[model samples]
Target: MRLVIARCSVDYAGRLTAHLPSAPRLILIKADGSVSIHADDRAYKPLNWMSPPCTLKEGDGDVWTVVNKAGEKLIITMEEVLHDSSHELGVDPGLIKDGVEAHLQELLADRIETLGDGWTLIRREYPTAIGPVDILCRDADGGTVAVELKRRGEIDGVEQLTRYLELLNRDPHLAPVKGIFAAQEIKPQARVLATDRGIGCVVLDYDALRGIEDDKLRLF
Candidate 1:
C-alpha cells in the first residue's frame, strides 16, 4: 500500500462532476490499484475514491489522474507532498465473527423447524446480487422463505431483508419468496415496518435457541 499526504485539490469527472479544493489530505493508492482521498472525518469512508478495475496515471510534477473502463476520471492535483511512503501488508485472513450472530444463524439453521411446523432450511447465506440472505428456507407449504438474522433488530434490518426479498422474488423458482426478520430483540418501529411490508418478525430467545426449552419464541 502506498500512502501520500499532500496539499492537493481533486476533481471527479464522470456521471457527475465533483471537486475538492486544495487542502492537506491523505491520498491512498492501494495494492488493488484503487485510489482514495481521505479527510480526517467520517470514520472509515473516504471523501473520494476510485475503486478497482481502474487505472492510475501519475503525470510530471504532482498531478495524478485515475481513469476507469467506463471513462470515469478522478484527478488529483498536488501542490506539495508532505509525506510519501509504501508498506507491504500481507494477505488478510478475513473476518472471524464472534459467537453471537453467527451462532444464532447456525442454531436456527440446525433447528429450522422451530420457525414453524414443516419449515425447512434451503440454504444459509443464500446468494443474491445485492448480498446474501441469512437463511433461505421453505415454509410448511414448501413456499420460499428468506430470513434476515440480526443481533438486534432495527428498521435498517427490516430494510435489508426487504432488498433481499425484492431480488429473490425475481427468480422464477423463488418468485413468491416471503421474508422473515429474526433477531433477539426487535424494535417497535422495525416490527411495524416488517409488518407493513408483509414480512414476518420472529423474536428469538437466545438461551432457548441454544437448546433450552425453558422460554418460547414469538412470531409476529
Candidate 2:
C-alpha cells in the first residue's frame, strides 16, 4: 500500500518549525513545513527517537501498552503516550519527566540571561537544605528569582518551593527574592497558595513546550 504523505511547515511561536505528515501514524513535524509519516508499526520510526523500534498495542484497560526492543512492557495514559513512544525505550515515565524538566531548567538558564538587558540567570543547581533548586536567577532589577520545575505533576511542587522561599527569606543575603514554579499544569490549590504568597508561576502543557502545536502552552 502506498501512503501519500504531505509536509506542512508549522511555525511554533517563531522559535521552531516542525514538519508534520498527513497520516495519523508516526507523524513528525520538520522546520521546513515538511511532514513525514512512518509506514511501519514502529511508533518512533519517523523521529528515530528510539532504537530497535517501540510497538504500541492495546492493553488490559484503555491505556496503551508499549513494548521496547527488550520486550519490556509499559502501560501509558493518553497524556504520556507520545513521550513514552518517542523517547528512549524501556524507560519509566517519571524518569522521562525528570529529564524533560531538567532540559527546561537548562533552557531557562540559557534564555533568562537574554530576558532583557538587566535580567540574568544566576546559576543552576542552587543548593538548599531540602535539595538543590533547579535555577536561581537575578533579574534586571537585582531581585533574586527562585525557579523550580517538574514534568508530570501540577503546581503541587509549589509546596516544595515554599520551603525554598522560607529558607531564602530567612537569609537576608538572598536579596528581595521572588519564587517561580514551572510545570506542565498548575493545580487550583497550588495556584491560590502561590498567588496569596505573591509568587510568580509559569505553566506549559507538554505539546506547547515541545513547540509541536503552535506553542499554545500558556504560562502565567
Candidate 3:
C-alpha cells in the first residue's frame, strides 16, 4: 500500500463532474492499482476513488491521473506533498466472523424455513466469482434466495449482499435471485438502504433460532 499525504486538488470526470479544491488529504494507492483520496471525515468512505481494472499514470510536475475502461478519469494535481511512503501489506487472510455470527449461520442454514415457509437450503458458502455467499436457498415458490448474515448489520453488509445478488442473478439458473439481509440487529440506515435496493431484511434472534428460548424475550 502507498500512502501519501498531500495538499492537492482533485477533479473527477465521468457521468458527473466533481472538484475538490486544494487541501491536505490522504492519498492511498494499493497494490491492486486502485487509488483513493480521503479527508479527515467519513473514515470509511473515501472522498473519491478509482477502482481497479483501471490504469494510473504519474506525471511530472506533481500530478497523477487514473483512468478506467469507461474513460472516467480522476486527476490529482499536487500543490505540496506533506508525506509520501509505501508499504508491502502481504496477502490478507480472509475475514473470519465471530462465534455468534458463525453459529447464527449454522443455525439458520439448519432452519432455513425461519426466513420463509418451505425455504430450503441450497448450500452454505455458495461460491461466486467475487466471493462465497453465506447461504443460498430456495423460497417456497422455488425462487432462488441469497442470505447474508451479520452479527450487527450495517450499510457495508448490505452493500456486500448487493454485490453477491448482482453476480448470482447473472447466472441463468439463478437469474432472478432475491436477497435477505439477516442480522442480530440492523441499523435504521442499513434497513432503509436494503429496502431501497429491494432486498428484504430479517432481524435475527440468535438464541431463539438456536432453539434456546430466552425468558426476557418471551411475552407471557
The root-mean-square deviation over C-alpha atoms between each candidate and the true structure, in angstroms, is: 8.2, 18.1, 5.6
lDDT of each: 0.87, 0.55, 0.89
Q: Write the per-residue lDDT of candidate 1 for residues 1-220, one digit (tens) a residue.
A: 9999999999999889999999999999987667889999877767888765589999998789999767999999989999999999877543354689999999999889889999988998887765678899999999999998888998768867876787787799887999999999999989997998799999998888896453346553
lDDT of 1 at 114: 85
Model 3, 1-220: lDDT tens digits are 9999999999999889999999999999987567889999997888998765578898998888999767999999999989999899886654687888889999899888788888899999898755789999999999999999999989879878877887788899887999999999999989998998799999999978988544566789
Residue 207 lDDT (model 1): 83
- Residue 42 of model 1, lDDT score: 74
Identify the leading candidate in terms of TM-score.
Answer: 3
Candidate 3 weakest ten by summed lDDT:
210-219
Clashes in each model (backbone N, CA, C under 3 Å)? 0, 10, 0
Rate residue 124 of model 1 by lDDT.
88
> Which pairs clash in model 2?
7-35, 8-33, 9-33, 17-31, 18-29, 18-30, 19-29, 19-30, 20-29, 20-35
Model 3 C-alpha RMSD vs. true structure (Å) is: 5.6
Q: Using lDDT as the measure, which candidate wins?
A: 3
